[model samples]
Target: MDTTQTGLPVRRGPRPRATTTNPHVQLDQNAPAELQDRLRDHALSLPGVRRGVSTVSVPGTVAFFLDTPTERPAVPDILGGEWGHIHPHTDGSLHLHVPSTLADDLIAAGWAEYHSLVSRGILPPIVIMLYGPRDEAELAVCSSIVEEAYLAAGGSRVDRAGRTLGLPTP
Candidate 1:
């Protein structure tokens, strides 16, 4: 795992694999239902965030979107203000749009990977698959990651640990 002084710590294990077709689910190392609920609640609690079905993911996932988006979003052209979504009771993985630079760091740190469509140019590089949190410690990191994604989506909130990320301009 790699680290950047002011970025997310390297997640503690190998990257999890995600399916390549419809549904695009995580294949292993899923989070428990309780932790998934906690993470969902945390994302929804961000300022201006709202819960809804994902516009870009399979049905049954819960998505987080801003009620009002910033003028310039880090990832543009998302449907219905959608910024991120979680596979709650299923794989528990999440899909989000983050600042491009942060997406690279997240991959380098083993916390996430670019969404498959990004490589095919169907999606921008900002779109990523954030791996699920398997324990309390991992949940803390996942939560912070989700917050960063939220900020990138035009929502405002203070940094959790005084850790300033390269947040997308609002």
Candidate 2:
């Protein structure tokens, strides 16, 4: 191992590929292909959101995570999400975060439920793993949920995606 400028040891071997246990390997969530494409397209179009690349990403999962520099949020509050993001997996389910109010509302409406693993360590309690957008209409609802999460993460959705757009001048 060699120490890098950041004072972390670096491995000097062929890098390994991403791996996953994939508990849902046999469970396809039944969302259509178009919906999956739409979700990916929309997420990349949002400001400061991008295709996720991490040390550990689940195999066969398409993730769009927030890339904005933001202040961490205080729970029971909705104004900011420190690192909000979403993963629309092959199983047709969703894993994401939204402000607590929206999360509660989604749970009430039967659109989603909490992922018990969120708070063990990986994500904050405010982040929940959503389940089931089993159809087109449900996918639309899913889009809105994603929009809210992205917004909470301090992302904007102008056509430029990641660029800052100046106000029109006189």
Q: Pick the candidate with the highest lDDT.
A: 1
Relative to the unseen true structure, what is the C-alpha lDDT of residue 111 in candidate 2, on a scale of 0 to 100? 53
Tens-digit lDDT track of model 1 for 54-142: 87777689988787864446667466688889985778999998989889888888889888788788888998999999999888889
What RMSD, rounded to one decimal, does every model reach?
3.7, 16.1
The segments of candidate 1 whose C-alpha lies over 4 angstroms from its true place after superposition are: 70-72, 159-170
**Quick one: how many clashes does candidate 2 have?**
1
Candidate 2, residue 27: Cα displacement in angstroms equals 4.3
Query: What residue pairs are clashing in model 1?
Result: none
lDDT, residue 69, model 1: 62
**Residue pairs with clashing backbones, model 2:** 29-91
Q: lDDT (CA) for every model shown?
A: 0.80, 0.50
